[model samples]
Target chain A: MHELSLITAMMDLILKDAQSRGIRKITRVELKVGEFSGAYPHALREAFAVASRATPMEEAELVIEEVPAELRCRECGAVFRPSETGWACPSCRSQNVLLQGGLELEIQSYHGRDGDVGQGRSRQGYSSGEQEES
Target chain B: MSVKVVVGKDILAVNRKRAEDLRARFKQMGIKVVNMLSSPGAGKTSILEATIPRLQKVRAAVIEGDVATTRDAERLSHLGIPLVQITTLGACHLDASMVWKALEEMDLSRVDLLFIENVGNLVCPASFDLGENLRVVVLSVAEGTDKPAKYPAAFLSSQVVLINKMDLVPYTDFDLERVLGEVRAMKPDMKTFTMSCRTGEGIDRWAEWLEKWVRESQ
Candidate 1:
């Protein structure tokens, strides 16, 4: 499905990040997927495997943090997460709750060797927004 | 060995930002953009084809989105209007970034009305905004009337619900009243139009309403 496309986009960012830090190999890639985002994690992993072949992230481990569904009550100022069934604010018990968050997907960080680390191989402070890529 | 990272950023937030920006641009240009969404085989393309003839007087352009086909654009091209085809490769829904790229490629200077036909799906498309003035959801009777109840988000977010394939109502057992009730349950004030692109029945009312809305928005 679209997971493959999303996986490709993620890999593009990861590869770019990995190359920028002069990293030889990627150990792990942390990601946060939201509940309402409709991204299938299993499919994404499968897509990642295909997209990561022969790259610095060939053996990269994907760590996904699934964010659950959350809603905000319109009647009351109560914010809560939805249960297994449908959306009903847990705090104020209102059905007229608007969805607030949990729909997210991001590349958190990666662990790998960034060339020689001076006296000690220290972890690099890597972030997508902080880096500019052409 | 091991690393723990926290990425609390929202991926869709980026798209939403772009969609908002596009909406602002559309408003400034006085373009009445309509982002149309529906399930596969829901008559979205057909409705667009039907709507184009009635929009002859208006300077309208179509931005067709699909997984990997230019057929929809080809269909609209027959109407002799500016059309841009966006192939998503494999994405289920069309996001704002792709739309921004497509919009940049299209001739938007003289366009009064812009129609963006999203990839056919009632689920994923609801979560993404394509910077349209109105999000119209098409529901054909052949698909069943219970769709509004099952997929409330699509119905709730839509400004107009075009109930298409009304001519097939004779063959199918779709309850028009029940579908209307379901849509009203979620959105009590939603406007709906029932028509068939095949027979071109009841298309004028929809076209008239759309024209009025476009004029008002401009």
Candidate 2:
């Protein structure tokens, strides 16, 4: 899927930002993807795992928050999320509406920790098997 | 302690910037690029095969993007036109960088109309812009009539929607009018064309539209 490409772009930006802040390794990445953005969360998760290998972002927890697709009625200017029937605005029931904010793909934030030479191999003692909680 | 940095940047920002640069270059060179998206077996390549010859007035070039095959490039190369092919290896869609590289391989001095045939994907390709002047999504009648409803993003982003394989419409249970109505609802001012590559029914109309844009761009 193109999620590989999407994740690649995200990782590039994240790594750049992380590097600028002197982050040697990343612990987690929080991303908000809109439903209408055409990036499925499930597929993106799988892509993230494969794409982050052998990098400073290896084994990082990827927290994805999905944004619901919203629409603005062209005829009535009423903004609402589409129901089961379709993308028709709930207020005016107009099918001819513009999508407002369902197509978002952005990184809200990320957590990174500096590499410690003193910790060395001891860092793998306990937390190696456990995920560091926020 | 781990630092949690609040970085609110669009993941596609890099691609968008590159796309804007390509757009400026195209504008400077007076080149018109059309990005075509479609699902597999939707007659995109066939439509291109049909339409290219008809637009004799404009010097048209094609950039074919496929997941893993040079067959599309080979097919278009037979026309003796300047065609560059980008194989994404396994990627689902083509991005601005890919098109920018493809453009480097071609001589744009005499080229006025450039067609970027995107990978056969209705979903991911809609999100990536190849810096085309116009975006057209092709749908074949055999694919079913509710396609526009199922894939709203493609219709929303496209300025033109082409319904291909019209010759097979009578055989399939495709409701042409209903499909058109749904397409209109998504994009009221979208330019639409109904054509069949096999029958050559409306190729001239499409070619004429391309000619008009090519001239206007110049």
Candidate 3:
């Protein structure tokens, strides 16, 4: 499955990030998987288990957040989730709509073992766009 | 005393960056690359087989991707055009790195058009950008009409869609109108070509359009 390759590539990133931060053990990995991103959550979890075997992230828990697919109406600028009746906008019935969301695939954060909150560490190679410490 | 640190990195950011770099390289080199994606047995190779002979006016090459076979490369190499095969062994899609590596094995200096035939899958192939000038999704009549709706990502990101196996449309229950309707729902301006390689029904039109694209890229 493609999930296996995806998982392997993700682990490589995780390992590289962990190494840079001098984090020996990863407690958890937080990810966001959009509904339209084409990666099934269950399949990703299964692939993670198989890909992380005997690795530094083997004991890590995988946490995922699902984002709903959203569309924007071209005619009226209406933002709405996918409709059951059709893809027509709820605010304005327009077939000329564009996808605005549900294609996100991001690794938001990770919990590293035995690290202090504010001060105790080496130069943690934290490479996230959001520098907010969870 | 575990610390929860915010990384906020796109998981695909690295791959996307690589693809972007490759895109820049292609642009600087003035190579028109096409990434063709489809489901297994959707006639990607067959389309190339039929289209290449007619593309004599354009200098073309192909990089074939598959899970575990070089048969496709073997087939295209016989055409006497520069072609290479990247067998993923078990991976379902071709990523930017694989293509970047494949480039080192071939000579693309005088290549006007480069077609990368991705692994035959509707889902994962859409996620990875392989630095192509155009993205073409091929769907055959035998695959049914609901594919565009079911696999919106592939159809949504494509520039031109090739409706293959039209010769079998009369024999199968596939509805061309329904498929096109769904394709329009995803992308209103997507260019489409309906043809069957078995009968060479609409290859000439496709070849002309592709030749125009190649010329425009140059």
Which one wins on DockQ? 3
Enumerate residue pairs that collide in model 1: none
True contacts kept of each: 0.22, 0.57, 0.64
Please report how far candidate 1 places residue A107 from its true position, in Å: 4.9
Cα RMSD for candidates in order? 5.2, 6.0, 2.2
CA shift at A128, candidate 1, in angstroms? 8.2
lDDT of each: 0.76, 0.85, 0.85
Q: What is the TM-score of chain B in candidate 1?
A: 0.94
For model 1, residues A67-109, the per-residue Cα lDDT tens digits are 7756677879787765544455566666566656665666666
Docking class of 2: acceptable
Model 1: per-residue lDDT, tens digit, B81-150? 8899999887888989888998778888888999999999887787678888899999999898678655
Off by over 4 Å in 1: A14-25, A67-95, A100-134, B1-5, B12-28, B67-69, B87-105, B123-128, B146-159, B176-191, B199-202
DockQ of 1: 0.20
| C-alpha RMSD of candidate 2 | 6.0
TM-score of 3: 0.92
Error of 2 at B3 (Å): 2.2
| Residue A53 alpha-carbon offset, candidate 1, angstroms | 2.1
| DockQ, each predicted model | 0.20, 0.33, 0.58
Superposed model 3: Cα runs more than 4 Å off? A83-86, A90-92, A116-134
Per-residue lDDT of model 3, residues B1-218, tens digit only: 56666777777777888999999988887888999999999999999999998985788999999999999988788789889999998888999999999999989887888999999999999999998889999999999878876777888889999999999988999988877866776788999999999999999999989999899768
Better by DockQ, candidate 3 or 2:
3
